[model samples]
Every structure is written in structure tokens, then in C-alpha cells.
Target: MASEAAPGSIGGAGTALPRHVAIIMDGNGRWAKKRFLPRFAGHKAGVEAVRAVTRAARAIGIEAMTLYAFSSENWRRPEEEVSDLMGLLRIFIRSDIDELVQENVRLRVIGDYRRFAPDLVKLVDDAIARTAANSGPILVIALNYGAQAEIAAAARSLAAKVVAGEMAVEAIDDAAIERELDTHDLPPLDLLIRTSGEVRLSNFLLWQAAYAELLFVDTLWPDFDAAALHQAVTTFAQRQRRYGGL
Candidate 1:
């Protein structure tokens, strides 16, 4: 079980803020249903939430903020929903890439790119290339990412190296595995937030969040805003990370 921490004061002043934070955006469908709107309406609003959270995170001194935008399991949803999601992603990239670059926010997409359409793949690649020179806060989008799949893939790579005699079996360690993970270049995950009161990791950064502080809130993804982000970070600042030590 993960350790629990008491909610801290609401301001980040004089507190240690997390360098890396990840969020599991949940309850979009529910939010839309409550408004008697289509699910896509909720997703569209969620995009706005993303923009707000990105700006807030950068302003709060966070080095990296990863958002669980899409999961491998999400493919099971209706076809129309999937297509709408893809469209929204394209719109987001085309519309927000400039602002991201201007703000010095490096955009990174982590997941299986092969599963996307050619144009979508190109958009993601181009976004990364355009922001490659930026030296500021990083925004990682976990699209079609699954933590267990990532772990298995990393293990296979290590096994292949051992089979080719490029790396000894005994040389495989936590550090080595980490280098193979998608977030190897980013800072360690410090805080993970899940909206809609979800209490699970949902296959998000499982390995990187080994010692991260988890905060679950009742606010739906579409309703999440900069203020909500600030509150979460403030709560994180008050946590005690023992990392298995006394």
C-alpha cells in the first residue's frame, strides 16, 4: 500500500514542491452526462483543463508534468469516441504547439506511436522536434501508454542484450531498467494526482511513481483548473517521503 499524508496548507510558499508531477484525468464522461451533453463535450472541456494545468504547473516551478491522456485500454470504447479523441488530439497539437514552444514547454508524447494514423504520428513527431530546443518545463502526454506493457518491453530489451552477450545477466538492475523506460530523461515522479476520486494508478508511471505522493480528488477532469493544481501541489509539499527509511 502507498503511504498517506495529511493535506497541507494551500499555499506553496516556504514548502518543497514536487519537481515532477503526473495526473490521471478521470470522470470526463460523467461530467458530460451530468450536463446532458455528449461525452465528447466533456473531452473538449478536458482539453481546456489541460491547458490551464500546464500553465499552472510551469508557473509553480514544476520541471515536468505528465498527463494520462489516453490509455491502451481506452481503445475498447466506441469507435466514434475513439475517432473524436484522435481528432481532438490533432486539434490540440496544431492549435497549441506554438504556445507551448513560446512558453518554453517541451512537449513529449510517450507510447506506441505505430498505433496512430500516419498524420497523427507526424503531428506528434513534429511537435517534439519543434520543441526539442526548449529548456523549460516539460509536458509529457501518455497516449496509449500502459505501464505493464512498458515494463515487459523493457525486460525484453534487457534480455535481448544478455542473449547477444552485450550485457551480462547480473548487470541488470533497477537503474538499468529505468534507462529503458519512457521517462528515463525526466526527473523522478514526485506527485501523482487522480481526479474524480479514483484511487488507482490506472497503469500510469508505475515504476517512476515508486515514492510519489498520491492525491485523489472528487473534481472531474473537465472541471479541474489551475487552482485545483495549486492545491494539489501544496498538499504534496507537505508530505513526508520516507522512501522506506526511518
Candidate 2:
């Protein structure tokens, strides 16, 4: 997790890099267990990894990054762990919003983030609004987000539109459904990475990642840094994307 790692290691390989990237930040608890520290410590360090990866993206000229901060299924975990996660969310927003604003990174949330505590919800909204006009890199945090739930919500939205005579049933298509999704504003997903040797998507961006190249790395989330990101992109560069065609 070297902070000073150079971003040029990724973008200068001559092969194309993904315009948009999503990460399933996994293995924080395992990382903590390996170090004999509480899981909360790993989550806290994972926050720094988020910062590092965001910086790496900006430096390497990537477009957008989406992080799976917390999933809807995470509520099934122990109450104290969930509480620690919420607290870390508060601290990350309050402390990092200024840096994000100054860096011209637009912040977006994909999940039902407003379901959190009123104060915390306000904090997230304010932070988002503060960075709304940034023109360069984008950061999307998926907190309490589930792809299935998002898709179902989008379906309901389309159904309502049809009922209101705004859209014909025949008008429903892949593009129409996509426009109703939380990631509608983002460019098509180009790469999806899961750290800590995880090989599954775990309900993150199932539809958008339909054609995106997948990378599962062994590094834990807390230890993933710029160099690791560069390595991932480099690997992505070497693959030939057929997009389901020859």
C-alpha cells in the first residue's frame, strides 16, 4: 500500500485501459484476523485503500470508479460490526469531502443511502452536492446497495411510466431498463475487480458488468494500493475483449 506509487505504471502500456472500473472491496475482516486486530481496524484501513485507489484512478486518467462500500446483505453481520461500519462511513465522508471537492472528483451513491440515520444521510447528501460540479474523475460508493434490488426498483419505475402513459410497453428494452438504473449516468462498466482472491461478483453490478472484464486478485482490500491497481489494469490490457463475438 505504497502511497507514492506511480500511476504511469498502468496507463502507458500501449494497450487500452478501462474507462470505468468497479471494485468489490472484500476480505477486510479476514485481513484483520490475520493481523490479530478487530475487524473494525481492517475496515478503517480499507478506507485509506479507497483513498489510494481513487487517487490512483485520477493519476492514471481513469474515468469513473465504483466501490462496494456496504451491501444490503451486510446487515446480517454482527450488530457491533455493522455499527462500526456506519461510524467509519461518517468519518470518511466528513473528513474526505473537502479533499474530494478540491480534487474535482464527483461523488455518487448507488444504493438506498438515504435509509441511514438522518444526520448521516444529510452528511452524504451535503458531500455529494459539494462535489456535484466536478468535471473529471467520478467516485461512486455503493452503500447498502444490491443489484437485484436496484433492478427491481428500476422495473417498478418503468412499470409506473407505462401506467402513466409516458412509455409504451413495447418501448421497454435493454437501453430503457438501463436508463432507469442507478448507474445510468456512468459509462458502460468496463472492468470489475474483486480483491482478496474472491472470484464472484457478490451481487455487485450484475447487469452493467455483463460484458465487463473480471479480475480477482489475492491482495486484501486494506493492502491494495496504486501499484496493485496498476497491475490489475495492465492485466486487463492484455486480454482481448470479444464482447460475445469473434
Candidate 3:
């Protein structure tokens, strides 16, 4: 990772550099294992990678970035690991809000807020509020988020609306379904990158990424840097995004 991130190594030619980049950050535990360190240490180091990627994206003129910080499936992990992640997130919110504001970056979280601790939830809300007016890149963190759950929730909400006489059952369409989703106002993803050599989507952004250019890399989440991102972007640039048709 260190060798890859050395100056003048990233953002090379053929980098498609999509306006919106969504990442499924993976492999923190594996990275820790390789280093013979605790998994929590990998998570901590991943924070630094997050900062680096955000800065790199901003510098490279990307408009939006969505990171899969924690998925709904992650609850199955050990309690200690989950607790450590929550702690790290709270600290990240407290420590990074000012920097986010200063950089004109807006912070958005897409996930089940109810699952987090009350204090952590409040801190996240506060951070979002503090950065709400920023005009730079929009940084979205998916905490406790799952596309399947989002779709189910949207369907339930739509069903409720139909029952309440607010919307007719026959009137519900794709647009209505989208409006019911948490990502209703966000742009569709242009590129989806997964690190740690993982080729699977792992249930991240299923709907939004339907038309996105997908890229996978061997670099672990804790080690992913500007160079890794540049590689993904460059690969994205090389592909012709047909969007399901020629």
C-alpha cells in the first residue's frame, strides 16, 4: 500500500473518473491478520484510508462518494468487533466534522439509524447538520444499511400509503418506489469499487449500482489509497457504459 501511494502514481491517463464513486470497503480483518494485529486496529487504520480517499476524490473532481462503512449483515460479527466499529464511527464523526465543513463536503448517512447507540446517532446527526451547507463532494456513509432492507422498507411504506388513501395501489410505479427509498434524491451510482480482491457486491447498493461500472482490487480497505482509486477510475474510463443497451 505504501509503495502504491507514493507521489505521482495515481490518477493516470485512461482514468474514467466518474462523477459519482461508491465503494464497498472490504478486507479490514484480513489486513489485520496479515499484520498479526487485532481486527480493531485494521478498522482504525481504515479510517485513515477513508480520509485519504475522500481527499483524493475531492482533488480529482469527483462529486459524490458513498462508502459502505457497515452493512446490515455486519451485525452477525462478534460483539467486540461490532462495538469497536461503533466506537470508531463515533470518534470519526466527532473528529472529522470540522474538517468536512472546512473542505465544503456534505456528510450523509444512509442506513437504519435506530440500530446505533443514542449518543452515536446524535453525533452523526449533528455532523450532518454541521456540513449540510457544504458545496463540495457529498460523502455518504452506509451504516447498518442494506439494499434489500431498503427495498422492503420502501415497499412497506408504499403499502401503508395505499392503505391510508394517499396513493392508489394502481398508481404506484418505479418513480413512486424510488421516492420511497432513502437514496431518492441522490444520483445513481456511476462506478462501484470493492477492495480486498472481492468480486462480489455483498448486497451493497443493488438498485443504484444496477448500471454502474464495477471494479475490484486486491488492496484491503485499510490499505486502499489514492492509487487504488485511480486504478478503479481509470478502469471505469476504459469501459463503455452502455447502460443496458447499445
Candidate 4:
């Protein structure tokens, strides 16, 4: 467990209590490489980090937390690595679904997760259904997701609506496009953090993070734990979000 991060109080650290936080978990392969271990070893280790971070975020009163589990480009990796990742996903859901249900965390996913094998898809769907009614924190996993594709798809949807005379083209503003986005149900992204010292978005959340606070740290995904997460949130608390205004 992490030391409590006091995001509700804003006196000392300013008023930026991030309601939603997203993280780009990176450096798993590198972490394994440095240890002379298989890349799967680091990825497997990263799962523990995910669990710890989820628990810590829930404890901190975060409304929603999104993790970049797999991007569309990830499929281009070695087939063995991809298979290992899928196996890990199955293991995580099977082993942790009960715990998530007990904790009242609602499980949700963005992207074409069905692209996975039918058995794995069923497992994921069952897990989602199991936690659909939970009233606690929402956990969003981006599997096979890409920001550019998401935006382009949303635009296509709106364009289709225009063609069908459902909504006029002039009405397609920010909110309109947002409704078609994968994160429409989740709270507005308040903080976007990338581990492993990566500063770029790397096609994570293009539209939702227009004004979100961005933080990059050098911690590897496999080593990221509750304390690192709490520290990141505390640092986020100290920043003042101008949102394009002084």
C-alpha cells in the first residue's frame, strides 16, 4: 500500500486534485533487458505495478484511471512477446476479477478488444459484466487502442451521421466529437503520466488530454509501485492548471 495521497485538500498544493489519471506504462522490455531477463519477465512484473497503482489510485479518491495496456502498434512486436502479453491478460483477469469485484471497481475497456482470441474475449467480457454494477472507482484499460485511429473513427462516425441526416455537420463541435470518443463515459482526463522518462503522448489520448497536466518520470513499468504513483499524484497536486488562461 502507498502512503496516503491527499488530493482532496488543495490548500498547500493548489487546487489540482486530478479526478482522472492516465498512465503510459513503458520500459518493460528495457527493464528486462537490463536484468538479462526475458522481456516477458518485465511485462509480468509490470502487472504487480498495475495492481498496486490501481489500489493506490482508488484510495486517493480518483474517479477514473486509464492505463495504456496495449496499443495498436504493439501488434508489430515479436509474436512471442505478443502471445506472452495475451497470456498475461488472461491470467490477470482470471486471477484478479474476484478481487476487483470485492473492491467495487468497475471494469471497462476501450478499443477493439474483441480482436483477441474468442476465449480471451469471453474472459474479458465476463469480467466486465461481473463488475458492471460496482460503484467504486472505474478502471479503463486501453487494449489494441490508438489515439489517431480513435479520432479518425470518431470523425467518420460524425460524417456518417451527417450523411444520414441525423446531425448537421455544423453541430459537430468538440462535445460532438467527444461523444464518439472511447472515453466519453469516463471523467475528463486530468493528468496524463508516462513512465520511463517518455515525454511524448505516443498516440495515447489526443483529444481528451488537450488541457490535462502531463508528467513524465524515469521509473520503469516493472518497478513502478504504489509509492511512485502517490509521488506522481503529489507532484501533480502542486501544479497550477491555467487551461489556456492566466
Consecutive 10-residue window with the lowest summed lDDT within model 1: 1-10
Candidate 2 matches the true fold with a TM-score of 0.95
Q: Estimate the TM-score for candidate 3.
A: 0.91
Query: What is the per-residue lDDT of model 3 for residues 1-246, given as tens digits with 9 covering 90 to 100?
Result: 222232222344424557778999998999999999999989999999998888888777777899999999999999999999999998888888888999999999999976788998889888989988888779999999999999999999999999999999999988898898887877778999999997999989898887888888888998899877766766777789886788
User: Residue by residue across 38-151, what tens digits does model 1's lDDT show?
Assistant: 999999999999988888777667788999999999999999999999999999999999999999989888888669999999999999999999998899999999999999
TM-score of each: 0.94, 0.95, 0.91, 0.95
Number of backbone clashes in candidate 2: 0
In what order do the candidates fall by TM-score, top score first? Answer: 4, 2, 1, 3
Q: Runs in model 2 with CA error above 4 Å?
A: 1-11
Cand. 3 Cα-lDDT: 0.85
lDDT score, candidate 1, position 123: 95
Candidate 4 error regions (>4 Å): 4-7, 10-15
**Candidate 4 to truth, TM:** 0.95
lDDT of 3 at 81: 93
lDDT per residue for candidate 2 within 36-106, as digits (tens), equals 99999999999999989888888887789999999999999999998899999999998899999999999
The lDDT for every candidate, in the order shown, is 0.88, 0.90, 0.85, 0.90
- Report residue 189 deviation for candidate 3 (angstroms): 0.6
